[model samples]
Target: AIALSSIAWQSGMLIGPAMAGPLYAIRPDLPYIVSACLYALAGLAMLTVGPVPRTIMDRGKGPIAQIIDGMAYVGQNKLVLGVITLDLFAVFLAGSTALLPVFARDILKVGEQGLSLLASSPAAGAALVAFVFSFRPIRTNVGNKMLVSVLLFGLVTVIFGFSRILVVSMACLFVAGAADMFSVYVRQSLIQLNTPDDKRGRVSAVSLLTVSASNELGDAFSGMLAWLIGPVAAVVAGGGGAILITALWSRLFPQIGAARSFDPAEEEA
Candidate 1:
């Protein structure tokens, strides 16, 4: 499994840029076609991966126990709930991603290449950061790092909302992506490291639900805000809300600051 996962990631990392060149040469829609192809390739690679775990009988805990433990853990852990809430807010305000196509056409008045750059720059920043993190090992003061990252993310969002220049907007989006990636890494690491083995699957399921909820709910929120006020105002307000939430979270969860390690056994079940 590990070897296959490594191979798949390395293959994507090596081959992903080739798609970008062709995508730029053709049309804006070609990127999606390229992405679909990459996804198909990834699925094929997964076939060579290790055996899949049995969900019904082989696992240590029954489905009911896992579900109950997961729910109970979530209900008791204020820190995890807090992280999830902040993630929700950040995702909600940052639905600016969905509006990038509109901005490329109407706001920046850029070409197909410009639109592709706008879409891909954020991912590039995140990919670079992920590469760095793999080597350096983010070990100390994770909570502090997370808070700083999210704050920067919100600030960059506001900056992107206000910028008229294409370069400036792209820069802001790049920074926002970098910040968001760091924050997400820390949050996911904390959650997974803190979750009990018996409840990992259920906890992961809840995280999945949170992701879908945030994306769909964020779309609705951004759309309504844009309609009632304006796109700029909606984006600015969302960024401001993100900053405020981060501040409040830091004040309320001070212990998270010194949390150097995550141990699920330490949690009260």
Candidate 2:
């Protein structure tokens, strides 16, 4: 089910650019206008959401207390904490997406169409991976696979940073996307399956902060680094930092690195 959702997400990313590029050519504002309408439609559709199942949660506590409870829950769970922090730092350091414009206009010299292609390349890779995982999910050495995926994501970012040719850069970005999706698959599965039903919503809210950090905060960090040094240096250093973080995390959370399967018994061991 998770894999299916991931596939859908990646597919949307693939389709969005193809449509946006042509729409952008016709009129720069067309894409934005269409996006706003779609968002409105989505908001309207949210009214149909069904009721949540009942759980043994303490309803008497206020929102702040519940949020704190969620935080404490995440802190106590090494598996969850390790997964979230790993993705947060690794993606923040990579920040490769933040530099797409610089690469398109200056580095790769591919122009507008090339920018769209570059943007879509990773989504293509991610969709392919998600499709495969839907059929044959990761069963054993789940932790190691996730760790390896992050490592590959960083390695590919480094390679992409040095790439001069458009095709090579696209290929590298594709691999990086695949690596990121793999880690996302594992991380989300751990969070969903391991967390209690009642705590899922609050836990998700907390996790969203890290996701923003990896995306928005990462962009700020990337842009600043690029201004300070250069695009290539910024990208290269970010990738290196992601790699280093992965190594340190593996050592710091031995149990996470040593995990064999997603079995509850094994996790409790």
Candidate 3:
């Protein structure tokens, strides 16, 4: 995970500025195409790298049975369901990033350079903090940390929504990114620790799908909402939604509240 994150972070840092310089000159939407290409290449690399073992793969079940069993296991596990739902909700509502170019240009009047920063600021902050976490892993109440991080992320989104100044908005986004990094670590670690060895592949695939669905769905929602109610209002609404989601999820998932460490023993496997 660290290796993949590093590769993506470095690749984006290198390509983002250069792409923004030229593409935003022609069309602000051009960066999305470039991003799509980069992601496509990354996906290709992963495919070529071959299959990875899932939690359930060690059980010796047939391939189709393995998939079905994973689904059944996930359905039976409230903790897993809660985490997955939380991930989907948070990512779906908070991911307004794809529309940042429009926000920078039309809303904040910051132009393309600002757009580039807005687009990449969260990842930049995440990459920085992730680097720190890689060297010295956090040992604390993981669940509370995730909740706090996600809450802060929502608050930062609200701050960005209200700010007219380019620097202020960017700073808010940077803070959001930092918070999101903590959330990512907590969630991913939780998934790994809780899942049975044989079911890892299917669960991971489902998680990946959830991520793609949330991001794309969030982008569509943001774009439509912005068109309907205006950009600032849309962002503010999304922030409000994120806060509500955190509150509801906190009440619903007591296991998440019990998270003490990143140890597999902390959760049932």
Cα TM-score per model: 0.82, 0.95, 0.84
Q: Please write out the lDDT profile of model 1 over residues 23-89, one tens digit for every residue.
A: 6677867877878987899799989999887444336777787677787887677667667667877
What C-alpha lDDT, on a 0 to 100 scale, does residue 211 get in candidate 3? 72
Per-residue CA lDDT of model 3 for 1-269, tens digit only, reads 64347536644663576467578688868878988997999899888876775332445667788678778887777767777778789878876676687788888887767777777777777767787777777777888888888888888898888888888887888788778777877777777777877677688677777878988999898889889998888888888888889989999987777778878664443
Return the top candidate by TM-score: 2
As for model 1, its CA RMSD to the true structure in angstroms is 4.2
Across 29-135, the per-residue lDDT of candidate 2 in tens digits comes to 99999989988988998988989867678899999999999999999989889999999999999989889889999999977788889989999999999999999
Task: Kindly report which residue pairs in candidate 3 clash with one another.
Answer: 54-201, 55-197, 55-198, 55-199, 55-200, 56-197, 56-198, 56-199, 57-198
Q: Rate the local accuracy (lDDT) of all candidates.
A: 0.72, 0.90, 0.77
Q: Once model 3 is optimally superposed onto the true structure by TM-score, how far is the C-alpha of residue 8 displaced, in angstroms?
A: 3.4
